[model samples]
Target: MTDTALDMSVETGAASYGAASVKDYVALLKPRVMSLVVFSGLAGLIVAPGHLHPVLAAVAILCIAIGAGAAGAINMWYDRDIDAIMARTQKRPLPQGRMDPDEALAFGVFLSVASVVLMGLAVNWVAAALLGLANAFYVFVYTMWLKRRTPQNIVIGGAAGAFPPMIGWAAVTGDVSLASIILFALIFFWTPPHFWALAIFRKVDYSAAGVPMLPVVAGEAETKRQMLWYTLALFPIGVAPYFVGVGGPVYLAGSIILGGLFVLSAIRVLRSEDHKPAKQMFTYSILYLFLMFALLIGERLAA
Candidate 1:
């Protein structure tokens, strides 16, 4: 090859190497968190009073999953600096320079808009509106406004995560109801204890990153105190679907047992000095939410 041709070949190779892999784009979605969002959205669709066509239901879930991914990518784009400082998030695609910030931001915005539009076309506009609102809240409210400003950031921002069930319910019924609101309440209350557990262990990271997570802004003792309170509040709200007769006895039983365990875990965190309870709480909280929703799904299927 001539010198100019060799130079062109070298530049092309470098560009190819610098391009983001598919896996990197997927990682920008925060797929593990997306899994939970998808599952919860599915549970909402299943337990709602009306029926949706299976194909449309799948679309609804897909939109929710994509919307979640979009919001997460936006969050990653905005938080790249702090993300790089935090040990737990330091390996993410943006922090590692696998993708440009603008690329991630555009990817997130595209997914966010596409997901809402798809939901509106395939399902109902109600669901689409809720999805749009959730994405907006996560991006504009939580990520931009509240995240760096307050210790109560996640507390208020938790509502953004709590909207999936309502969206799912709206997918089927085209309207919200008391049951859907109760489902929303379940997640809203659970968010504090669940995330505070993680914040307890990740306090150093939050501190170093200059993010005022509860454990970073308040003392651990106060954070533990709040976790226990939220867990207590969650107990009644979580089991409400059963008392409302939407779920059968099986659900009621599971809710009581799981809720008791969650409260106990919070109590342990409060009483102990080690991070073990907080760590355990963080791990089990995921299981707790999953099984709690599973009970509602199981009862609906069985009925």
Candidate 2:
């Protein structure tokens, strides 16, 4: 090859191998999802009976975020085929061919291992184990196995997301407790309604992707009914932190109001014939979880 042609070929190979930009990699991490995971983990750290050094607490949160992102990156890589078929996901790095699949997989695996190892070194093995379990559940259970196979995917898979707070609690206390379990339940019950609301609104995208989302397999009416039941279940679980002594009276009252609104949102979804209610519920669900965790964290800090 001529010198100029050789140089061009090298550049072409580099581009073909891994030309993805920083943002594309960030998309692989699913930063928006990471934010909620981090926040919940922080809440767990803040409310646990023992104090973690601020530096170690920060490390724990970082580990949780990285682990969550690692799972997300692996999920994106695994689902790239379905992602390409779904309009909403079509522009993602893997689906768009902006990133090499092997590179993405390696990035995810590396981050997963690093996050767990660092957590064990910097925090406690209990926290590290939970983080590893969450990552494995998200990747192997939720992404690889459950997601395409069943309508109960999010319901069963939601356990993976619920682990962060428990992990954070263990980072401080070095063991899981009733308070942490209540926190876990809060997120576990919340996940179904939250994702089902999105599924209701994105039925077409899910149906086209050949993913067996509740709405795709069970129908929207059934999905909405299930969402309502989960939201109803969430109300009591949201307030259980208060009963368990992790949350204060302010949290108790706030959770009541928030939980009421959540139920109302589900009711709205049930009554509406259009997607607007589901879309609204989806947006509100994010805010509800955020505020619920914030309330607990704030109340604990104030005490």
Cα lDDT computed for each candidate against the true fold: 0.92, 0.93
Candidate 2 lDDT by residue in tens digits, 85-197? 99888989998788899999999999999999999999999999999999999999999999999999999999999998999899999998988999999999999999999
- Cα lDDT of candidate 1 equals 0.92
Count of clashing residue pairs in every prediction: 0, 0
Candidate 1, which segments miss by more than 4 Å at Cα? 1-17
Model 1, residue pairs in steric clash: none
Q: Pick the candidate with the highest lDDT.
A: 2
Candidate 1 lDDT for residue 216:
90
TM-score of each: 0.95, 0.96
Candidate 1 lDDT score at position 231 = 96
